[model samples]
Target: MLTYVCFLVIISVSGGNAAIHSLMYTYLATSGIEDVPEFMTVGFLDGVPLVYYDSNIYRVIPRQKWMNMAVESDYWDKETQISIRFQELYKININTAKERFNQTEGVHTYQVMYGCEWDDETNDTNGFHQEGFDGVDLLSLDLKEMRFISLVPEGIPTQNKWNNDSAWLENLRFYFSDLCIGWLKKYLQYGWSSLKKTVSPQVFLLQKDPSSPVTCQATGFYPIGVTITWLKNGQNHHKDVVLGELLPNEDGTFQKSSTLTVAPYELKKNNYSCVVEHQSKTFTEHLTEDEIRAIHENYLPNSTIVGVVAAVLLLVIICCTAYMVYQKKIESESCSDTTRRPKETNPSVLFLGETMLLAF
Candidate 1:
């Protein structure tokens, strides 16, 4: 078997709320003197054009733009040469995405990921690629056969015969397994290192409404394997506990929350606590009856507050407008009365005319 060094890179983009998630992979061989790095990218999104890129460029270039520019500009030739060489690879990515994401229709969540791998040895190279939904692998590739493969949660039928070819077998033996194994080892090493590094969690207890469950939220923790439990009077209360998934934070840490439901009487009578376990450390937080009552008393529901504020502002605006209108009406009435009232009779002028007539 020929020994080789290989590198694999995977990029994934995912979306939420009826959006499609995309996964792409590229492989490179670095062992032989003539080895050249190979690259590819694929994206799955509704109404978005297909995406593919090789070593010639780092950013994503749309297929339509590449095609149109290929004939118009000299730079197109250089930029598209690698793409032309990897046309089959691009097609595989597209087909795999279509099969996996159902043409990206009715998708609610999507993700984008980047992965790289390197091997040392005959200079053979392999790329291990996969795409999925909801943590389930949907499609992958058989690098040796240069064919698409289906994964769990949804399976596509395959009639590919190249796997049986002796040449394909030879390539698989020399390149594929070694590259995958090397990548897996690297991944495990990184994961182990991450687990060793820990950050304390910031925990809070909040209740939005009296009818809703009280939530114990823990955020900014590392390694993602943490548990939150509700305790009543020093005893675990599993019946009223609801655990949430570990969600990633913007800083590469994780957050999770657990909720506890209790009757109004129970809440008043019993002391409730939130207990957290992570990386061999345990944390306990007790919620006093007074504290719980304070949360309810001090907190005004956002929706209610918003509605009340909006209504009050609207009322003030309406009252001001009505006052202005009434003032204008009063002013107009006063002016009209002044204009309509008959002028007082000029008694001095009448007497002066009578006296002048008598003198004449």
Candidate 2:
């Protein structure tokens, strides 16, 4: 299994009146590994991990708040059983793969990623199923031909066997065309409130010193779609620019970075800026004294300071709100029966309504 995996979300989700969304699951089985799980799986929706299960965990666990709905609805139990089946199946698959490679003992992996993508705008759907051994493709599904195709020479026999099974072919057809799409749509419906919301990125420019590269970082973005580029003189980008991968934040938002490498002499003569495009908004940060932040003195950036202050303020507000509610509750208890307080409405239900997935 890859160490820093975000799952193989084959299709990137695009935004519009009706955007493209994808649901993918990756199953990985490792051979002769003591520190890691023997089998694991991750499920992604629109490039975000919604659920995960490892041999050690032994049960499916929800990763997002919206995913808790599955637990409340008892879907997680069914999923856990399915994952257990895959855990056993993939172990055998990995052993077969090792035998095919003529290896007796070693650390290796057998991986599979399968999913379906739907364009809500056009009502079009696409499905994919790919398997790999030791990070190289071994077999892939060919939907048009209704068969599994071998990607490597060793996979030919397995591909032929899978293709010759008429019942398996029919099941595959129904799964990709109907079952997968139905499940994807149902998940979308269940989590649309959280998935549809978008948060603008907070951009920052950081540098260690004058000779160091200037990194323009954008954080707190949602939807997992963003572009970061360096511009020179408001037009083309600087000669040396490195774009980083999109990563998830602890708060479920996303972050990305673009770095500009230039000499100090070049910095004074030309104007370089970092431009970030997310959703329908554009943010630009220039390389200047006011924009650049220094970390040599162990000082935090303005963004970090602001975030800390905001968090404190939010805590204060929540405390005040709770205190006020407590006061009101006391008044009610004095005026009416104390037992009635227990029957009062839950604050979470009142505020979150049906949006609350699970609190405990």
Candidate 3:
């Protein structure tokens, strides 16, 4: 159940103007867990899942159809081999982590999130790398400083050692600066036809009750970038409106909602409407007292604003969970085998560590 929520993923919409494309990978390894694999890895491109690997399957499987069609069987054959190698390394990682923390038992995890972003309009590229133990960041790579930094005192030793290793640092430099970016571009090129696809949004006006706020909902949209605004009698309105986060549908589309608080008396007198803007489309949902009667179809009665947000989050969040699919038992042991020697290391996979390095 270890979770890390530090990375603020700047997702992009494919058909939007000036989209920042990204490629990110998350690796999780566990110890002292049942019904969960010893290691798992998931890769994302522009917020869509691309590849998934786990100890249970001992294979690197594409999560999206485009990915499978774009890549060859030999590519998967090579990736499976690499993933199998990494699984052994991750087992050693878990064992080593327990020793560093001085914990003999209980479930613990090592997680890493590393990736790069490319701005299509500007051709600018950025890299990100970070790792933690048991859900807390222990070491994160700082490309600007060319160093590993530890926010907590306990991680200082490992940070200093990693920074001092020139060969390892140089490999990381190449890994992020060139290799990661190269891979991202290749994937984008391979999947351009599929990645550039877009689906228009469908808008709805909903009210939970006469006393509750009226909500404007936009669902079944692709690319994920959109805006919901309130218009009062043809003029832009901004008062007492709450916007929801972009949510993913099971079919790869997106959804969002915005709530407007207006008195029943005003609803009858004033013309209030919701405007949703997405790629090449503008959807306007006009609010009416008649729409209030439709509450039974789509509404959650929650007084507190926090509860409303939480309720919205709870509705589809669990179904969209990317993790929690692992299958196996884990050992309460030491850390991983030396990371494959940096030289001749494959660029397809790069796994950072909390307290250990593969070895230069």
Candidate 4:
């Protein structure tokens, strides 16, 4: 999962207040032999993608006929180059993850995340980089270790080559920090001028399976700092709650979901609601007993209809088979009766033979 945070900050720089852009980008990739495909995402500011990605690759959009195809073609070429580099790095990280997990086969996962936060106004910047294999954080920048820490299958390797070269590490940090700052500056200068539009979420309560938790989804919202929570008895319940990552919508908006597990008795007895906060506006949607009942009631009729159709089809098949068997039995009996009957001679032939014999 790729996650990042970006915000506009008013900070004092050179004895004057300026609108500073704080931005971060987290690049994450996970791969497994089964159950999970190779996936990569580059996230900026609450999981928004500067480039759209899915299905193990980027989603390329076609340019209009009136647009300049040459320039658009170059743009796509650059994106493809970047995607190739990311895939190469992903392979390296996933291989290392496989070794660390001692997994030669079956399902396994690996992830690499690189994040940097920069404030151009204050000239303050921080760098974050980490690698995870099989849900374990293996390599990261450790202040106490004074270098990158690597957790291997054999043991933890605290001493790295970078430990002896602090200047090198600082140079690396500056390089990435400058890159983000420059990108953010360019975005502010040319990409967007007005504030992002605010949109209210369309909330839904979904239960895919009876044994699974109930999901509360909020879609088609913008300006990404939205919070979605499940409340019980007018209070937030975090114990059985799972908060999902924010996702970008097709229209440059945002979407998120949260799930909660509650017993039927508790849900009926206590008041439950999905509370959403976005752009200083709060929206609350309560879950009622009637709504729950309606969901089950709606599902039951469809299931009953399917069952009834199947039963009718089975009965028809059985009746048809029984009729065929009875017809075959009747045919066998008719053939047996024809074969068992005695043959009779012609009466005229017998009378003629008797008259000839009396005359002789």
Candidate 5:
């Protein structure tokens, strides 16, 4: 009974398509093959090889020999040994105990194979090998020049898993589904980070002219394998972008930058941001309308300061004039008093009525 259970487990594991596809991809990658195939609905495409998954770069290869060398140099599945054959070659039985390869000229093309399967001991040597289709030709591909393209796994979601106790299978399904989704999300994030580093070193923005719009500028680098953009409110800006030079770094990495003319209106408000796209991630430096205003906030005009000082001086003059007017009024009153002849009658008044006064 134990042996029978083990047999059933083996069959079940082998029959899982998802598990099988994962193993197949890993096996081919380690086989030192130059051309990495892209998975599609029908099969896989080997013409355009995947070079960097993070950058999503792929190159096309025309020949099969380069692919073979790449496979042999890399570590492949120890238990799996793949076979290949050209077109018009003889075919083998599908049910043969050992796994075999099939060569065809369909949309999905196989460049290499490596792996093994369970089979009978007596007929192990007579196992079926890979067979090919007719008129499928090989090209002389150069490994170095091949372009690399990024391929994203299909149907992968980015979400957390749910739990339900109504059915045991529901819980199992949620676990597996969420696991794949989480993996894909993390994988993409890591790839983007790596890609950003490879694209450029440093970038910045500056004012083109005091009167003109704010311009994005860079000192240490040129744009390559990356995009430079100016944004307003999370939208792409469609203005002329000025590109800078690619400067050398001590660490052997390249540096580049770009500049854009912020519209006069936008600059007035100071609502703008510069975005650098390397790989799938974006690095953004932003200035809000308030921020831009603040940059020049302290720079008051000389004329304005002078005007303010003049107004203050005028206020002081008015106050002084008022005080002068009050003093003049007091001085006029004092002068009038001094000029008035003391009533002239003080001494002479006695003599006037003397005759009548003598009788008294």
Candidate 6:
């Protein structure tokens, strides 16, 4: 069992090494030059496997030796070196953008680089070190030469991923980083342009009097980014202003809102402006404190008035009910008086009858 395990371990290591060497070989072959060693130093940098091929030495540098060489200060400047490039296998087409998102998943792409050592360092055995020569691993070079470059498109993972009700937008951003650097840059630009065109900025102002103090709120949005500012007489009023929450949209865009409290007299008498900037242009709306106050005050809460009217109507009904009961009592007493006078009315009738008989 132990032997079998050992055999499996050997196979795995060999396979990994072979894979690294193969990548190195491919990179060297593409250069069409012969100064590099036949062997390769291979490892992973930021997840992507790197294979560095040397032409002078025909054998790949031992893994242990390569690791040591990468850390050694003496070999840092002397190691075999070549131009490194990232290979991007998958790309997302920008034109295929869905009008509405089902998900906000961003793309993450792998950037693979295979470098070769092509300098005329003859005694270096390319990457293969002789038993006596100082060893070097070309793969673990300095952090400067070997690094990860993120090719995430700017707008592909747009503000849509960050807004309310934007689960789809959020999910899609993860996959957008999978593009190559060139494509990502271009796509980011396009996304920014689209965002600038569709975003709208609004300014809100609350005034204390017709022309005294005005509190202002400004918000701006765009595909790339958004900013809010309060301007009093052409100067930014950052100290007296209150900023609200900066909100993000579903398309990787942003929404920003803020309030600036200032003297309405100054704002109304001077040039007061709220400017919203997008990618292509700036949208501006200007008004005085008095004008803004008129708009805000004009909106009356009618529900309160309605409630008061309903209460008065109920009170009137109760008063009318009580008065009707009082009048009913008065009518009942008058009827009683008429019943008591019945005897006097009978005597008058008798007298009238006697007079009629005499005339006959």
Off by over 4 Å in 3: 1-8, 12-20, 28-41, 53-60, 74-111, 119-124, 132-138, 234-239, 262-266, 292-347, 350-360
Could you tell me the TM-score of candidate 4? 0.55
Q: Of models 1 and 2, which has the larger lDDT?
A: 2
Q: Highest lDDT: give the candidate number.
A: 3
Error of 3 at 207 (Å): 3.3
Considering TM-score, which of the candidate structures 2 and 5 is the better prediction for this target?
2
Error of 2 at 280 (Å): 4.1
Q: Which stretches of candidate 5 lie over 4 Å from their true place?
A: 1-200, 212-224, 245-247, 289-360
Q: Please, what is the whole-model Cα lDDT of each candidate in the order they appear?
A: 0.40, 0.61, 0.63, 0.44, 0.26, 0.28
- Candidate 5 residue-wise lDDT, 63-97, digit = tens: 11233332333212210111111111112211110
| lDDT by residue for model 4 (254-336), tens | 56788888877777789999898876478887877666545544442221122221222222222222111000000111122
Over 173-256, each residue of candidate 2 has an lDDT whose tens digit, in order, gives 555676567667777877777677788998888888878888888887776678888877878774788876555554556667
Error of 3 at 47 (Å): 3.1
Candidate 3 lDDT over 106-136, as tens digits, reads 9777766667778877888877776666655
TM-score against native, each model:
0.43, 0.72, 0.66, 0.55, 0.23, 0.26
Task: List candidate 1 segments past 4 Å from native.
Answer: 1-105, 108-176, 180-195, 292-360
Candidates 3 and 6, the one with greater TM-score: 3
Of candidate 5, the 10-residue stretch with the lowest lDDT total is: 324-333
Candidate 2 pairs with clashing backbones: none
Q: TM-score order of candidates, best first?
A: 2, 3, 4, 1, 6, 5
Q: Quick one: how many clashes does candidate 3 have? A: 10
**Tens digits of per-residue lDDT for model 1, 235-294:** 888987888644444343556789888776788788889998877477887876656557
**Is 2 or 5 the stronger prediction by lDDT?**
2
Worst 10 residues of 4 by lDDT: 324-333
